[model samples]
Target chain A: MKKLKRSARLVEMTQYLLSRPHTLIPLTTFADRYGAAKSSISEDLVIIKEVFEDEGMGELQTHAGAAGGVKFIPKMPKDQALIFAEELCRQLQQKDRVLPGGYLYMSDLLGQPSLMNEAGKIFATAFADQEIDVVMTVETKGIPLAYATGAQLNLPVVLVRRDHQVTEGSAVSINYVSGSHKSIHTMSLSRRALKEKSKVLIVDDFMKAGGTIQGMVDLLAEFDAEVAGVGVLVESGEVESEERLLRDYVSLATLAGVDSKSKEINVKPGNYFSK
Target chain B: MKKLKRSARLVEMTQYLLSRPHTLIPLTTFADRYGAAKSSISEDLVIIKEVFEDEGMGELQTHAGAAGGVKFIPKMPKDQALIFAEELCRQLQQKDRVLPGGYLYMSDLLGQPSLMNEAGKIFATAFADQEIDVVMTVETKGIPLAYATGAQLNLPVVLVRRDHQVTEGSAVSINYVSGSHKSIHTMSLSRRALKEKSKVLIVDDFMKAGGTIQGMVDLLAEFDAEVAGVGVLVESGEVESEERLLRDYVSLATLAGVDSKSKEINVKPGNYFSK
Candidate 1:
C-alpha cells in the first residue's frame, strides 16, 4: 500500500490537476508512473506548469493528439491562503468577536468578503505546492488577507502602505513597534512591488506583538525577496512565533486567554482545515 | 444562420452546461434535439441542475450510461459577466487610484485579492444561475469583494455588522447618507447567518453615497432575504443612480467628479464586467 514516487507522482499529479474543472492527464501516463522519461515527465510538467501559470489557477491545457493530456481548468484556486484562514477562524469564533480581555473584535473579520472568501480558501490550500511569486500584506488590516493570498495564489498582490504615498514609485520604508509596543507603524513598499530572489508568500490578518510580523520580515529583507511562507489569520499563542518564517500556517481561531469572570474564550485549531 | 430553434438550443445548452466544472449531460440528447420527452428531457435536466447548483459554478453528473452523454463541466461562465466588467474598468482606470476629488482611491483596490479574484469570478459568473443563499456584505470595504463573491458562489458569507452589541441577540438597523446627511449603520445577523428566503448577494468594495449600498438594502429588507443582485466594487458616478438598491454591478473603476483639477481625475466606465 505504498507506491507513490516520481516526486510523489508529481505532487499527486499537481494536486489532481488542481481539484477539477477541465481535467485532463496524459504525457504517457505521467511517463508510465514516473519510471521517468517523456523527457523527464516533461521536466516535471514544466515545473508544475510554471507554478500554475504564475498563480491564476487552472489553464495548463497542452495537447498534441492521440489523446493528448495535461488539462487542469477550474480557475481561482490559490484561494487566498484558505480564504484567509477560513475568515480567520470564523472571526475568532465570534461571540461578538470577543475583545476587551480576550481580544477578537477583528473589525468584522477584517472587513468581510464572506470571511475573506473562507479565509482565502484555507490559505490557498496551504500553498498548494509552494513556490509562490508574490502575496505579502501589512497595512491597516493585512490588506484583505493579502488580497486573499493574491486571489488564491494567482499571485500579484503587493501593498505595504502606511504612508510614503505619491503613488508608490520608489520606496521600502519600515519602522515597526505596533501592537502593544505602544505606537509607531510605518511600513511602505513598491520598489516595483517585489522581485529579486522572488518566492514570497507572507500574509496576515492578525497577529499580536510580533510587530506586524516583524514589519513584514524587515520588508522581505528589503526586497531581496525569498520568504516563501508565513500565513497568519489569528495567532498569539503567547506570541513568539516568527519561528524562522513558519513554513505553513492557519491559526483561524486561537486566543486561549481571558477569564476574569468569564471573558473565557479558547478557540485554536487551524492548520488549514484540520478536520 | 437562424437555424437554432428548439428553445434556442435549450438556452445555448443551458449556457454551455453552466460554464463548467463538474461536467455531466444527457437525458437523451436533450430529448433528441427537443422533439421532447425523455421525461421532458429529464425535466429540463432538472431545471439545469437546479440552476447550476443554485448558482455556485456547477455539478450535474448523472451518468446512467449505455455510454451516456451529458458532459458540461464549465460552471461560472456567463463569460464571468464580461470578466467582471473588464475587471471593474481596469481597476477604475488607475493613475494612482485618483482620490481627493475624483475619489477612486478604492482603499487600495479594496485591499486587493487578485482584483478580488476577478471580482469574484465576475460575480461567480453572474450568480452561476441563481439560488445563492448567502454572501452579503457591508463593512469597512465590502469585505474583500464580499468574500470573493462568497468563494466563487459556494456561498455562506453573511456580515452586515455596523453596531449591534449585547453580543447580538437582535439587530437589523439602517439609516443612510454615506458622504453627508443621515448616518447610523448596525446590521448583525447570527441567527445562524441566513435562511428564511435565502437568495442574497449584496457585495461591495466601494459605492459612496448609495449610502452603504442603501444600508445593505435595508439589511436585506430586515431578513425576509432574497435580493440576489446588487454586486459592486466602485460606483459613485456622483451616486444618484435615480434611487438605489443595486441592479448587479462590477465596477473596477468609476468616479467622474472633483476633477476641476484636483490634479486631474474624471474616470468612467462602471459596468466593467457584465452578466
Candidate 2:
C-alpha cells in the first residue's frame, strides 16, 4: 500500500475499526497499512476517538504495551436509546397490531435490519461489561435480535431448536410449561452447540411469563453453562411479579395490555430506562 | 453539530455512510450536520469515495439534481469473495463435521457474525443491480443468513415458518415434499408479512435437491410475488441435475461428497467462481 493523505487515512482507518468491534488492532497495523509513522497513527486515532465519543457512537479504549492496541466497544447513549425505544412503543401501540387471540404482530418490526441493528446495540450496551462467551436465543423470531446483539459483542450465537432434527445430531431436550397456554413444550440444544461452563447471554423478541426463557435456562443447565444475562425486546406487563419465572432481566419495551374486543393495545418503554 | 477539521469530518462521514447502506443522503444533510459548505462536503465525499474504492469496501453513488443525494452500495470484489468461499470449503471439509446421517454440522459456522457479514456482502454484490424488495428464507438455520443479506442490501427480511403460529395471523400455508427425507412438510407466511407483487431474494444455508427453496417459491406465488434471485451458502453436488427442483441460483460453496463410514467430507467453491 502507498502513503495516503491524512484525510484519506482517517476515513479508511475509521471504516476498518467500525467493522471490527471489540477487537484490538495494534497501532503498527494502521502505521504499516498507510505507510505512516506510529506517532501519526496515534494522532489519527485521537481524532477518531473524540468524534466517536462526541457522536455517542461508542468508546475506543487504548491499551499501552507490546501487545496493546485499541478496541471499539459499541454503545448507544441512554438518550438516543430512549428515543428509539419510545419510537418502538409508538409503533407497537398501533391498533392493527392486535391479532385474534390478543397477540401482537411484531414480525414487521423485527424484519427491518436498521431497527434490529439499533435494538441490538441497546442490548449490547446493557450487557457490555459482562464476561459473556456466547449469545443464545431460540429459533425463529428471536434469532434476528440475537444475531444483532451477537454482531455487536463479537460473540457466537447458539440457537435452541423447538424440535429435535436429524441435522442437529445428539441433543439434550427439556420440557417446560408454556405460561400463556399452560401447555408443556419441549426445547432442545445440540450438545456441540455450547461448551461447558460457558457464560451465555440470552436475548429474545418477546417474553410472557418467561416460560420459553426458563426452558432455555433449564436446557443450559444440562450443558453446565451459566446464564450471564437475559435481554428481551418486549415483556408482558400483565404477568404478576409472583408469576414471573425469572427475577433478573432487561427489556426494551413493555406490553401493558391487549384488548381483543376493542382491538386496542398499549406499549411503553421497558425497565431499561429505569436504570 | 459544530464544524470539524477535515480529518475528523472524513472519519465521521465515513462511519455515517457505511452504517446507512443503500439509503440516499443529500449533500445538504452532511453540510448541515457538520456546519460546512456543500462544496466542502463534496470534497470530503471525493476522499471517502477514493478510499472506499481502493480498499474494495464498496461504491459511493452520487445522484445529481434537486432530489439527488449520495447512496452507498456495499460490494465484495470477486477475488476477495472467492478467498472467503475457499476458506468456507476448508472449514466444511473438517472430518469431525460429518454427522450420523452424513449431514455436516454447520450451525457453528453460521453462528459466526463476521463470517456471515462477508457472505452477505458477496450475495449483496451478486444482486446489487437487481430490483429486490425483500430477502426471504425459512425458519431456524436460514434466518441469520437472510438477515445478514438484508442488512447489506438495506431490505427487510421475511421468514417462512415451518409450522403455523397463532402470532402470525391469517397466514397462507403450503405443503411441499422434503427432497432429502421424501416426506411432506408445511410452511406458512403471514398475510401481513409480505405485500403483493414484491420482488424477493431467497437465501438459505444449504440446498439438497432444492426442495425447501422450491417450497418458498411456491408460497411466494400465492402472494403474486416474483422471485428476483436465490442464494445458498452450500449446494449439494450429490443431487443429480434431473433431481434438482430449481435451475437459477447462486451458491458460495458446494458439498461434493460426505461419507458416513470414512467420515470424509469434500467441499469446493460453488458456481460463484465460475462466473
DockQ for every prediction shown: 0.07, 0.89
Which runs in model 1 stand beyond 4 Å of their true positions?
A1-41, A49-68, A71-267, A270-275, B1-116, B120-144, B149-159, B162-275
As a whole number from 0 to 100, the lDDT of residue A196 in candidate 2 is 98
For candidate 1, what is the TM-score? 0.29
Residue-level lDDT tens digits of model 1 in A1-275: 23443434444455345434244678887676556667766766666665555444445778878888776543444344445445445546556555444544555445445466456556665665677777777644566677765655556676677677553455788887775555787878867567777887878865655667777777888877777777777666655554323434555555556453454555565544453
The residue pairs that clash in candidate 2, if any, are none
Q: Supply candidate 1's per-residue lDDT for A273.
A: 49
* Model 1 residue A272 lDDT score: 47
Q: What is the lDDT of residue B111 in candidate 2?
A: 97
Per-residue lDDT of candidate 2, residues B1-275 (tens digit): 68898888898899999999999999999999999999999999999999999999999999999999999999999999999999999999999899987899999999998889899999999999999999999988988889999999999999999999988889999999988778999999999999999999999999999999999999999999999999999999999788889879999999999999999899999988997
- On DockQ, the candidate that comes out on top is 2
Across all candidates, the chain A TM-score values are 0.34, 0.98
